[model samples]
Target: MKNSDSGARAGALEVREEQDPLLHRLMPSPDPAARFFWMSGADGRLRIEQCDACEYLVHPPSGHCPRCGGDRCTPRPVSGRGTIHSYTVNYQQWFVGQPPYIIVIIDLDEQAGLRLTSNLLDCAPDDVFVGMRVSVRFLARHGVWYPVFVPSQAMESDSA
Candidate 1:
């Protein structure tokens, strides 16, 4: 797939080895505060950090709460249902014969502003749209569970 606008800036993205070796090789840094969020997928669950004091959901787990500046936070399971806030189809061939893929920003249903950035799978680029309902699926690599989203209907049919 090629971008219609030739003036658009091309960006490099990290693709899984199981998918293809694209450009850079950067692994998730070992973060104690985010260990639960990363490893929770081992059991097929999506967990995010929540401020123990105010009960606000936090992503990219920070040890301290941004709301009340509370130092205590805990990992909580989420519904894993969300809507596409925005997305872009990457068409640059960082590697030869690399197919275009959709990267999306998802507005998680749990909270008003709670969101997550991840890849959209099992759907063609043309099929993706803003406000599309999606569900989470975890991809395990190097003991880290990376959450990827798919169309809600596709997920239901996958389980059927």
Candidate 2:
């Protein structure tokens, strides 16, 4: 699919607008712990928090490392490559005129336990499965970009 901004294929997925009211309601305000994450997203990169003291990569960025209690952490860019660890197809109409969507728990290849919960796009919900190789595509809404995943080229070729 053509990316709105670059007119190129947007990673492996198509970007969708953030129309879910609940999602908008729950979106965290930019703060110290997560400001870098948002900034990186705006800059078109996927960054995960890494604890300087223990080298632990933390998702859902926190102020301190859960493993070492270290407050010294920094945002680190990742490969944006991963596999579907788990997922669910939501048919409920949380937003009017929206179709069913897949919510996936992705296991990032960068580190064990380094996972992210995000939407799976550019494919039917029925096509998503555990262990499916996928890559990230950034979607922008209200000037903030969020990462969504789509089937990797290998998977697409395998299906073809």
Per-candidate Cα lDDT values, in order, are 0.74, 0.72
Q: Which lDDT tens digits does candidate 2 get at residues 1-160?
A: 4333321222433255653323542455867788777556555457889999998999899867999899988888776778999999988886676688788999998898789998877668778889998877766666556777778873344334
> TM-score for all predictions?
0.83, 0.79
Stretches of candidate 1 off by over 4 Å are 1-25
Clashing pairs in 1: none
Model 1 lDDT per residue over 40-145, tens place: 7665667889999999888879977888999998898887788999999999877677788889999998898898998888789899999999887766676666
Going through the candidates in order, what is the number of backbone clashes in each? 0, 0
> Residue 138, candidate 2: how far off, in angstroms?
0.8
* Steric clash count of candidate 2: 0
